[model samples]
Structure formats: structure tokens, C-alpha cells
Target: MDPYGDTLFNEQAAQVACQEIAALTLRCADDQRKAALLDLAELLEACETTPGSDVLLMGD
Candidate 1:
């Protein structure tokens, strides 16, 4: 089995995305600053847990 071929593997990709958003938030202009900050906060909240398939695997 090749783990590198797995589409479900994230390797903390979401965390990386959040970090990029944070950098943008710091540099966002005044007009769009509030929205950018809100976006960063929302992404942070959504990343608190890993999402799983509704159907259980054979082990479950």
C-alpha cells in the first residue's frame, strides 16, 4: 500500500492554509481587514477536529 497515493491524507494541510490566511490578515487593507480577520477566525474554528466518513469501517 502506498501511503503517498492516499487522497484522504491531509498532512495538516488545513493548518498550513490557516497560517497563510493569518499572514494575509496582517497585511489586509483597512477596508477589507475586518472580513479577512473573520475569515481567519472561522477557518480556525472549523479546523478544531478531523472530519470522518459517516459510514463506519469494517473494524467499527
Candidate 2:
């Protein structure tokens, strides 16, 4: 795959993972897991510092 394609695929995967984490947090009744997923979501948001093409896919 080209660099651009690879970036798109990776970004899609990250978005899917974030969605899954959010769903799990809502479905599961574990406070620790919910907290951890919330933390992960925050960290992922912080890590995305660049305002590139992925920004659109990531909801910004």
C-alpha cells in the first residue's frame, strides 16, 4: 500500500477502536474498564496534534 493508503487505513482502525471502546464502556458495568477506556480516548485525542487529512475522519 502507498503511504497515503496506509495512513487512511490506520486512522480508520483507530476510529473504530475508539468507537468500540466507547460502546464497551457503555455496555459493560465495570468501572475500571470504563475509566481506562475514557482515559484512552483522552490520550488518543491528545496524540492527534496534526491538523491533517485524518482530522476529518476523526471528527474534527
TM-scores, one per candidate:
0.45, 0.51
Residue-wise C-alpha lDDT for candidate 2, range 1-60, written one tens digit per residue: 344433332345556767777878889788888888898766555435433424223321
Q: How close is candidate 2 to the true structure, as a TM-score?
A: 0.51
lDDT of 1 by residue, 1-60 (tens): 643443221326555656777777778778577696766556554653456312111221
Local error of candidate 2 at residue 49 (angstroms): 6.4
lDDT of each: 0.53, 0.58
Per-residue lDDT of 48 in model 2? 50
Model 2 scores a C-alpha lDDT of 0.58
List the candidate 1 regions with Cα displacement exceeding 4 Å. 1-11, 33-37, 51-60
User: How does model 1 score by TM-score?
Assistant: 0.45
Q: How many clashes in candidate 1? A: 0
